[model samples]
Target: MRCETRLYNALNDRMRRSHGVAASQYEFLRYLRDHPDTRVGDLAAFFAIGVGATSKGMDRLEGRGLVRRVPDPADRRSSLLELTDTGTQLVHEADETFGAIGALIQTALDPARLHDAAQTLRQLLTALEHDRIGTPAG
Candidate 1:
């Protein structure tokens, strides 16, 4: 937990300083970029966050002109989200920022060790998600 927190803080601080985006917001934006027209509820479910909180976050992004919400034709009560051109561009640049971090890590640590750690983390995440498949989300 300590290592995770440190990594998160460092990464988020760098991302925000370099691109005006926090790590959490970047994750949300990247998801929207890949899944255009996704509903706020669907995003909440995917991220295991509250729908209300997700909607509020979306509102902020909309206010910043990085995203826009449109009425869902099939479901009038719900809105579908799409990334604006600026959001798309930011995501593209953020990819490079993330890649640069990976490069820095590889330079500081053995690339083979980093790959092994990444693979182990992936396996752990998969198992964790699989275990929660039939469980209720907070």
Candidate 2:
């Protein structure tokens, strides 16, 4: 828990300083970039955040011109999110920032140990997702 908190704080701080984006926002943008035309509900589910919070976050991103929502053709009530040119540029910058931060962190760890730890964390995350442990209930 302590390690997770420290890492989260460090990453968030670095992202804020380097990209002018909070860690959550960076994460949202990253996912959106990878999965274009995703729905708000899908994003909320992916992030394990509430629908309302996801909507507000999208609103903020939209207001900043980082994200744009187009009416979903099949679902008129919902919209599909897509990154704008500015958003794409921001995501690229954030990627660079994250790479630098990751390098800094890796420098302090043994390569083998870091790899092992990352593998373990990935397994855990996969298990959690498979079991829907943190997913919100309908």
- Poorest lDDT segment (10 consecutive residues) of candidate 1: 129-138
Per-candidate Cα lDDT values, in order, are: 0.86, 0.91
Summarize candidate 1's per-residue lDDT along 11-100 as a digit string, tens digits.
798889999988888889999999978998888878878888888999998999999999999989978999999999998999887777
TM-score for each of the candidates: 0.86, 0.93
State the lDDT at 69 in candidate 1: 93
Model 2 residue runs over 4 Å out of place are none
In angstroms, how far off is 17's CA in candidate 1? Answer: 1.3
The CA-based lDDT of model 2 is what? 0.91
Worst 10 residues of 2 by lDDT: 96-105
lDDT (10s digit) by residue, model 2, range 1-138:
997788778889989998888989999999999997799999999998889899999999999999999999988998999999999999998898778767877998899999998899999999999999989874
Estimate the TM-score for candidate 1. Answer: 0.86
